[model samples]
Target: MAATASRSASPNTPGQQLFQALRRDTVGGALLLLAAAVALIWANSPASAEYFAIRDIELGYEPWHLRLSIGQWAADGLLAVFFFLVGIELKAEFTRGDLRRLRTAVVPIAAAAGGVLVPALICAAFLLTRPELLRGWAIPTATDIAFAVAVLAIVGSHLPKALRLFLLTLAAVDDLLAITIIAIFYTETIAVLPLAAALGVVIVYGLIASRFRRFFVDRAWAAWVVLLPLGLAAWALMHASGVHATIAGVLLGFTIPAVVGRASNRTTDADLGPSSQGGDGSGIDLAEALEHRIRPLSAGFAVPVFAFFAAGVDIGGSHGLAAAFTHPLTYGIMAALIVGKPVGILASTWLATRFTAGLDPSLRWADLTGVGLLAGIGFTVSLLVAELSFTAGSVEHDVAKVAVLSASLLSAAIAAFILTLRNAHHRRESQE
Candidate 1:
């Protein structure tokens, strides 16, 4: 029994750190909300023209052909870094978290599928004849993970803990789908020269990581240093590659050295060497390492920064209530996010579980329904997609932004309502 027992003494340390990082103050969730609120307030002020001008103004400089222009550059380029971090998140979830097992992933994946399909179909039905708007179908399928979680935090204890997790996982899967779609659908044309160069840097970086791992290098930081900048370089190259610049994030994320840490044990050989590459005092737990390395950067810094830029739509502008509400693209987008999202998610998840594959037994439809409504709040990715879905200054783009912001706020309200109601039910059941 003594031999069978093992101890890490602090296995939960990483999870605890991540939990703290994601809270109202730590992840900048509160600040993000404040910034967003202030931005809207300022944008609506008489100095609102200055707000738009600032967002449009180019800042920064680039030497050695490395462009560092701000405004859209900060907006689009830095966001590529944000997406790269998201890719890391998606990879980690599949490798270790709720997505690690088919049984666990089933409910959320199905729900996410339903959420995405319904909104897209809603958009199609509303705008199919105007092929111009068809491209933006993907805009409504995402839920802003940070903002949604922040919303829950503000609403106090009325929401169930289980529902919060369920909503988060569902949104994670939704993010995964959105990443795939961005990679597959939005690519423009192959500009071979820059792409070829980006490929070289990535391959070289991977080889370096593999070599270091094979040789048992303990400094995981080295791997990330190479991986992140190389990813940025890839984004720069891909900008000219006819690919949507964001896809670079996904590609780079897949390649990151998600290699886990080896467990320590007194019995293991002190220096097992390259022949037993996974040996430390124990063996590799690749999932743990990936979570440790990437989660901090993504959840703490990258995601928050990304939100600051993407969520800063000029709502305080000359958008008269009619201009905002009457736009077909606006209303269509609203319905797609608010109405179509939950309904579609419910329907598809139902279909998947009943006829094809079933949801995880741990989850219930009512639980999923609450999550589905939250999934309707598509703030982050919706805004990102709007940038791609429309050219600058077009009516399509303006209306889409207003629609996304409006729908997301409404969805948040609806989800909160449902969650509170569900909590009441849970209390009743427990009492019974």
Candidate 2:
């Protein structure tokens, strides 16, 4: 009976199986860290020249301004895959998950807002004297969900499930805000024709996915054959539009329907994953299906590759290290990420609990604090913003990268310490 139940509980499809493995926070986080480490080591090694040579090698059609460096391809192309997964998750939360209800969603939403605003304000304050450096204010505002989840998985085993839910919802909202900032502030210019074409393609893509969700869901290869090309077209057009191609990924993700048919008796809990459990009745769930299929590719390959290309910053020497640390821009980002993120998140969460809903009964203030500090480990999107904020290879750019790296490390260590202690306390309480 046990073996039969175990087999019955397994993921139903190959895509679902792969998604289960890749979605493990540790797997994705380890790959990202490994890639970033390789890039950092290579950039500072004897073969540093070769590293930059490969990264700078460019190829693409010149007519559409698609030609770009290897690094640029990782940033502008592969990262779109990552953002696409993010979009699916965001839509799921809004449509069926915690964010669906005002009562359940207020805390994370308010906390995310505080997280973004406080960090930006703190960073901006530090860069006030140097107005030129203010463009990078958003650099410290992002929360790397993969990294935070990985850390939590390691140290938060005894923590309440509510804490994990809070973190995931908070990060989702944080990603949405980061996307908005990129679409608005980072886009310096736009080509109206390409932008319009991109939107049109996105609409068509949405229509196909919604209208023919069963078609794609029934045949696993259908999405790859049909929607993949359309998604790429939208991404390409959006790229040409100069609106940041990753935005195309999010827009495309938003179009997929979260719930397909009305609640039916046949749909099992396992079919819809954890989020769509009680309420949805499990119609096709195209959004969840597509997310599972593509997430492995995004988390396993695309994000790590982007990290490798983006994290290869060269510090000249001991002198350069000192200079980067002392530079106003670097320290400013460090302060904002390490200090502001926690203060803002904690303050906002407290205020929300006071007025709206209280913290989960199983949770304590310390757990929230640890999650806030963990959020300070901003890597993926932070690096992207750092890239966009300053010229490549410029002093400000390198300094900003260094600051993000340093601050993230410090934040992770501190959060780990606090959470480890909390985990112990919880374990002891359970035993008692």
Candidate 3:
């Protein structure tokens, strides 16, 4: 599932080619939506039993607790690849991108926090009476970057670049918040020995990645051969430690240095090889290089596969669509996503601007509003949280999935409508 670079690439440089391929956020989002659509259709069809059977079939080494259903493998195993990419992006942002400066980073960081906190409060409010159902309060707190960016690319061609950058930074921080919630709130128990072993493996993995940066950079195969096994070992240990296995990806990502080497005034193009230069002409660090190589896998295959398995809830069950829609949990999730996300983000951004340096001058309140609405399109991490919150095959699980799917679609549609109009206005202003 390696994606070809959509933008022009240096013919000689594979690293740049991979980075260009990763720029195709639209394609990734479409594939993810298509997979979910197929899952829903298949699950509701007459052959639905076959779909569940295939998803339920178990395999793997038993003694290590590795034996899991196909659906479980998609969630616990393959989705780690997605989280690994998230980890790399977070490191890049904090070390080099918008989050590098405290003043520049404050608004998006605060907005991300507001985005998470409000939706969670909304969920908690709805589930106050039904304390048993409160475990799912985190489901609507995530923003699916792929989906939100895809919508922006489609409807915001004329919008300011600042808007998109703001969305990207906000979503990155949103993902960090979601990762923290998962690691702390979702873990029911922890095995101290396995947890400690996993951390030790992560430390060792980081040391090697840092110590031998140039060696791995020179030979792309070296990372696959050396680091892949260590990553898997850490993931396995994390899984055994009763924490979600995906946290291992974040731990490993933090170990990779975001900047490769110090910039020097004397350095020239002639002195650097193709692998050393990024698309923007900065030094290509290990984290960026690895992210480029792995993003295609994460976006094209790993996430879509996870969506296929996770999104296959039978709407034609004995309880039917009405019951699922009317479920108190469903209402909580939908409201949190469709309403709480935008309000929280807008309010937080307003406060940040009022108290701090303020937003980019080119961006208007309308643009921020659209991006805020776009953040409501929470899919991948939302589904993952829903799974973690409820037992599979239980009524609560199915209802939560229904709520997430419906809310995401509604959010994307509403955001698209608003942003498309905004795009037209911007075009008219440009012509004027």
Q: Best-fitting candidate, measured by lDDT?
A: 2
lDDT per residue as tens, model 3, 1-432: 012221222325775555445558888888899999999999999999999999999999989989999999999999888888878887877888767888888988888988999999998899998999999999999999888999999888899987887898888778778978998999989999999999999999999997777666656788999999999999999999998998898788888877844342221121122344444434547786687667778887899999999999988765689999888999999999999999999999999989985888889998888888889888988999999999999999999999999999999999999999999999999999
Clash statistics: count for each candidate:
10, 0, 0
For every model shown, what is its TM-score relative to the native structure? 0.78, 0.92, 0.90
Number of the top TM-score candidate = 2
Give per-residue CA lDDT, model 2, range 278-361, as digits (tens): 243346678877886677788889999999999999998799999998899987899999999999999999999999987778
In model 1, the Cα lDDT at residue 63 comes to 44
Error of 3 at 24 (Å): 0.5
Ranking by lDDT: 2, 3, 1
Model 3 C-alpha RMSD vs. true structure (Å) is 4.6
All models, RMSD in angstroms: 5.8, 3.4, 4.6
